[model samples]
Target: VNQLGIGNYLNFKDRLRHKNGKLKYVEGSAHRLDAQNIQVMFNDVTSRVVAEQQIAEERNFVFHSLDVMPGIFYVINHEGRFLRWNRQTEEISGYTAEELRHITSAEMIAPELRAKHKEFVASILSGARWEGEAELCCKDGRRIPYYYVVRHFKWQGEDCVVGMGVDLTERNQAERLALTYLKEMQSLSARILESQEEERRRIARELHDELGQGLTATLLSLKNAEEQMGESPMVAQVKHASSIITILTQQVRALSLNLRPSVLDDLGLVAAFRWYIRERVESAGLRVVLSVDKDLPRLPALQETACFRVLQSAFTNILRHAQAQEAQVSLRQADGNLVLVIHDNGRGFDVKAARQTALAGKSLGLLGMEERVRLVGGVLEITSAPGQGSEVRVVLPMG
Candidate 1:
């Protein structure tokens, strides 16, 4: 009232006592009609004022909730201007709220990823929900991996993108750790397999050289004694003893060969495969066709050993379980890799079931073959189904 003068008007909102004695909000205007008289008008605005206050309170609550969230939450306009963001956005970016308001979303992404980020934003603005992983560049020169999901929506009648980003630092670290452990385990497995082969070879050599020769010499001595007996009662007993020793010698020789075929070490993989096919597969009544590339070069010792063992295991499974009549084995060099394939025409078993059984330790032949191939940095694939033949294929890098 004191500020108002003639030809001057003032507008204000004030609290006034209503007829019921409750306080009410009023919007009022006053104008001095003359120096001695003034005109005044007032209108109730209580409802509007209350609604505005409630909206402000709700908005504050929403912001507080977003700040408490673990992941990054943000809303950006189609022009990439930051409209809203959670506390994590500022914390992770090493930027203050006021600084973030001045920068575009692309500026927060790694420089090399800016183009890709733009494309992703465009996809969201085109009404497609997008999710992907990217590295976020911080003000402190740190790059943090994040996976984000974003969608386009309307906020306050303007195009906006709302998104949530999860930090992938822990996940990436865990993945790397797991991969390192896996490599270590694979290295250990390879060493174990190599040691096992070495032991087997040593045992086979001893059996063949020492035990086998002793049995043979013993049989020869018995034969000489029988010849000198001259129809005596001891002659028949000597002959019987010689016959038993001969059988024992043959059994020992067979065991030595089975343990680690001398041909594998003396003649190379192809010759060894041929010997095994003729001596083992054919002996089991399974007709086998062997194919070899004439130009196949001798591989590294470990590679050759792995391939032979895989082939040996596959054939063992076929003979014991496949009940097949015909089989085919092929060894060749293709695309800088040593390829070995064994196919058998027989009643095949469920490959998935067999793998599960092997995992449970009920079956080990399939697992053994797979491990041998993997130890040499190779891939082994077995395809089989009931009533259909099985094929085991191995591809080992020549390098």
Candidate 2:
């Protein structure tokens, strides 16, 4: 019956190849002796030979390519059962094809990685490609990192997983170590900045309270003596000397304040900022307003300093770049957050341009401000456009 079914194929193509042009195409099963089946059968036989050769060539190519890889290659059914593995898989997994075929995917992988592997398999079998890096236990119980690419496919009409994996244990470890070192360096930077700020506060306090007051008193005493002398031979010299000393004392006081304001320690962040705004803004010839929430709890030392430093930098920007006539600094607690806003009626430039200025050696002051805010787990937002004033807002999480 099988031979009868295809016997007409022999003459079908022979009628076209070697015989006269009396050949016509037919589509059913067998033809009678009036039309030869010899050509048809011969053509069908030739087609099968070519098809088999193409399949053999394709199989050879795939297997040869996989064999040359320095990784494991595998095909598994949707149920996580192995279908095939190349020679490289044996070298990597220490399991022969027969041995692997006897094992399920979970049996070869360690107990710990089994669940994750199953998840990957399930995701891939459901028509998604899975690509990932993971540590898997080898046949000798040694864990190794592998980078894998899994593709969903159909093998013999059944859903299957096909994938290749390269060992990445050494390179992956190097990257992890490098990342750890970088984090350590960053932590050291944060701590160094913290310590530097603490030391600055100490020095500023000493200069303001001890050296600053002593010089101020000395200048006042010299002035009094000059007045009492009332035209002595050295009166002119002493009067001139007293005025010089007074000027020097005031400049030194300003330097100390710039280093770290004593009011920041004595009166808390709000009062210190209030004095700062009044002096710095007025000195810059800008009208300034200060508002502090009436009844707010004391903030942690770190948070207060961060907030104050941000405000200080903002005002400095106003004086140096804003060229504004008025500014406002507001500190308040609303919705369980510390909100600080600095607004100025200045000639605002594009923030991107301001950043480029920092890039061009004109300080944005934003890096310092952002670093401080990030250190305290707070967020700082800067908004500005050309011809539009800048609003710097800081939202600090409260504890």
Candidate 3:
């Protein structure tokens, strides 16, 4: 017999002779053989196998969940090298698993931001959590904005950091657009005040040039007629005075209509629009189409005025810039808001560049339309490209 090691302090292996006279090494030998000890060893091996299977299954589940997570998940070692990362991290950074493992976290930070990020990581390792917005450098030479949350952790008995981050690219873009619009609004406000003064000056000049001269001529003709009463000359002078008075009345009526169309105040939006389109647009030899929802509710006076001004501005732009033969204007209720759309099959321009120019004071008409819509809790969208028709869409909150 010889000693063996098999889950016990002592074991025995003996050479046994079979019935057919063949010799073999048997594990349960009679040199201090204990069945209870052998059974305990068997139980220990079974328990270990079951425990290992459960642990493997748990590890697989955790990895799978991490892979499908929406945000970027990553772990970095004490040396700042990537120890592990989820699929989202690879996608956002534009680096493969093999590439990430070979590079330190500093390489993923923007060049100008490396020094600050290093200190941030150092603070995290010292037990202070780091949470903030920063830009991460991508493999394709792009910088991706992100909001990150990071903290220190013990991974495999070594110091490390586990972090989760959300991409902020879309949010940042929205904020920039809002800021640009704000600047445009400030410029528009200044322009509005100037425009009001200019309009007043124009009205004064028209009255003085047309109405003032006509009235002065009529007064002189009447005075001359009174001096030659009962004479043929007096009859001729009276006839001249009547002619001058008739011409002055027509001029005054035209000016009154130009100042504020009475139809707009008496008959509402639809009636006013119809009258303007026929008198102004059609008379200019341009084809015009107007569509309005039959079931639209009565809107507030301010809202109605805003819509009218925006529409009027759109038409003017089409006439001045677009050389199209046809134009369409439509108004309807959609998704709890009133929507206005103006379209023309005319020469178009780059919308982004045009908007920039307008905001820069080169084109106040476009800026004014946007501002008018915005004041009534609405948005204006202009879409156009060179050689393609332009479309202006506005949405106003109904309430």
Model 2 is weakest, by summed lDDT over 10 consecutive residues, at: 35-44
lDDT of 3 by residue, 210-286 (tens): 77566767767676675767666557767777677767766675565555456665677777778778876788888
Worst 10 residues of 3 by lDDT: 37-46
lDDT of 2 by residue, 80-99 (tens): 88898878877777776778
Q: Indicate whether candidate 2 or candidate 3 has the larger lDDT.
A: 2
**Candidate with best lDDT:** 1
1 or 3, greater by TM-score: 1
**Model 1 shows how many backbone clashes?**
0
- Deviation in Å, model 2, residue 368 alpha carbon: 2.0
Poorest 10 consecutive residues of model 1 by lDDT? 1-10
Which prediction has more favorable TM-score, 2 or 3? 2
Tell me the lDDT of model 2 at 166.
85
Ranked by TM-score, top first: 1, 2, 3
